[model samples]
Structures are given as C-alpha cells and as structure tokens.
Target: MKKPIYRTKDEELAQIFSSKVLPRLRRLEFFGIIMAAIVLLVVILGVLALTVFRFKVPDIKLRAVTIDNYSNLSGTLTRFNLTLREEIVLKNQNFGEFKYDKSEAILSYGGKTIGEEEISSGCIELTYTKLVVVLIEPKFEGLGSNQNLGGGTNSGILTFNSYIKLSGKVNLMMISIKKRTREMNCTLKISLVRQAIQDYYCH
Candidate 1:
C-alpha cells in the first residue's frame, strides 16, 4: 500500500494561496485598475466635448422706439404722458438654439421706475434674430407749471434708461446644457414735443 503524505498546516495554507487565492486577487486588482483608467478617460473626453460645444450669449439691441401719443395743456407741458413702444432685437450667434425664460423690461427715470413690461418665455433659433416689442406708459410728473414746451429746457429732451433681464438654459442637440443670465442696458433720448426718439444706445 502507498504511504499517505502528511503536510504541515502552514505549508498547506501557503500552497493554497499561491495556486488559487493569489491568482484571483491579482486578476481582481488588474480589472479594477483597468476600469478606473477607462472611467477617467471617459470623463476627460466629456469635458473636452463640453468645452468645444459651449453656448454663447446672444446680442440684444434696441432696434426702434416710437412715442404713440403725447398730451400737453396750457401751452406749458405738464403731466407729460405718452405711450413708449420699443422694439428689441435678439440676435443669436451660437451654434444652438437659445431657450429663454420669462423676463422683464423696465423703464426708469431719475432713479424711479416709471414703466415695466413682461417679456414672455421664448426660444431663438441658431443664427437668427428675434424681434420683441414692449409697450410702456410713462407719465412725467413734477414738471414746473411754467415749463415751456420744447423751449430749450433741456430742449424738451428726456433721457430714460431701460433694462432687460433674462435667464434660461441652453439646449444643444436635445441635450440640456448650463443655465445663464443675460442683462441688457439701454439709454434713450426722446423729444417730448416731437414725440419721437432722438437717440438710442444699448449695451
């Protein structure tokens, strides 16, 4: 009969580890390292893609302005009230459409808010221009009773400023990108007597 081989507990454990458990542990570690490298590469590519396809802010300009009506009495203008109509053009210079949320157009004079109009949510196509019209009713008060109409008293020229605040997200090929805000400030000069816009500038 063949004699049975007797091995120490330490030797058995070391042989088992070398043949079975060690190989499995090395394979698992290698797999983990490969997976981490792949994940890192994916993240780096995503960042690069986002940087290349980033959205740009649109341009806002005051295209035209008109004073519909003006009322004056006693040969000296008091309560200079009129309807101010402004046309704002938004030009999109981006590669994707700009989706904007509800915004406001405010008209102010002498640090006082005189008029406000709501600009509803809308979208501007890529490389397109959108025209938005806003109507403002402003009543000029505290004009001295002796103020002659258009008599070199500032030439009956009133200066007013407008602000447009818009906030929205950008969409790139059905993928939603980051959110941004656009602010437009404009200065306007109007002739109360002629009821016309003299000069306009926006930034």
Candidate 2:
C-alpha cells in the first residue's frame, strides 16, 4: 500500500476556509446588501409618491347669490316670502377628473331648517371649474317677533342670517376615493319695497 499523505494544520485550515466559510460569507454579504438596498429604494419612492404626487381636494365656493322674488304683507310685514338663487362653482385642480355624487343644499334660519334643494350629480374635468345653480324658496309665517331679524325698519329693510350645507363625494377614474362637504353662513339684507337683495356676505 502507498504511504498515506497527511495535511498540515495551516493547509487544512486554508482548505476549510476556501471551500465552506468563504462561500457562505460571500453569499450572505451579497444577498443581504442587495436586499437592504431594494427595501430602501422602495421606501423612498413610496414617500415621494405620497407627499409630492398626492391627490388634492377640489375647491367649492358660492360664486353669486340673488333674490329672485320677495313679497310681504303691506304694512306690518308679518308674513315673509322670498326666492333665492345661488351659483356655486367647483374647481378641480388635480390631474384627474373629479366626479361627484348627487348632493343637497340645505338652508337654515335661526337654527331651524327652512328649505332644501337638490344638486345634480356631475363631473369636473381636470383643471376645470364647473358652475351649479340652486334655487330655494322659503316661507316664513310670522317674522314680526323674530329676534334674529336684524334690520327691521320702516323703510322696508330686513336682515337675517342663513346657512347652507353641501355634501358630496369625489371619484377618480370612476373609483370613489374621498368625501367632501362644505358649509356656508351668510348674512342677508333685503328690501321688501324693491324685492331685491341689498347686501350679503357669506363665510
């Protein structure tokens, strides 16, 4: 039989490191580093997308308000009647179209509901503004003792506070995403003699 060859300690150690330990450590380092970089990149992109390219809510405002008709009892002005017309505009400043559901415009006086009108469902194109008109007719039985009436004078001037509420949703690409609502309080001055709105301010 041939003589058996025995390896020295240093040679055995080198062989073990090259064949087993070195390969395992290399594999771990390569995969671990690549995975960490991938995770970091994903997080950065997610944050940028949420903050910089996020969707924005549309702007709604009352463009114009008018009193179409007004009538009251001749001398005492006890019974009050009036028709109000409002023009609302919705401005969409996003990159996608803004679709809204059917909504209502509610009118209130002295914390009491007076009238309500329906706002039709529609969509506003990207970077566009849409106008919606609403008409409300409210009848008052006895305004003679209402403390909320401001300018009750002999010249037939009357003042009151009115509230309007608008509620709807926003849709993107035919998918519902967010809900939107707005409330406006307005002070109105009316002239019973001329059947017109004298002054108004809304907030």
C-alpha TM-score for every candidate? 0.66, 0.61
1-203 per-residue lDDT for model 2 (tens digits): 99988999998889878876899988999999999999999999998678534667677777777887666544455456678898888887665677777777766655566677888888888789998888998645334443345456456776656655555555556666666666677777777767787888887
Q: State model 2's lDDT.
A: 0.72
Best by TM-score: 1
Off by over 4 Å in 2: 1-52, 72-76, 142-155
- Number of the top lDDT candidate: 1
Worst 10 residues of 2 by lDDT: 141-150
Tens digits of per-residue lDDT for model 1 on 1-203? 99999899998989878876898988999999999999999999898677646667777888888888666654544445678899988877666788889988998876667788899999988778899999988644433332433343356777888899877777778776867777999888887677788888888
- Candidate 1, residue 46: the lDDT equals 93
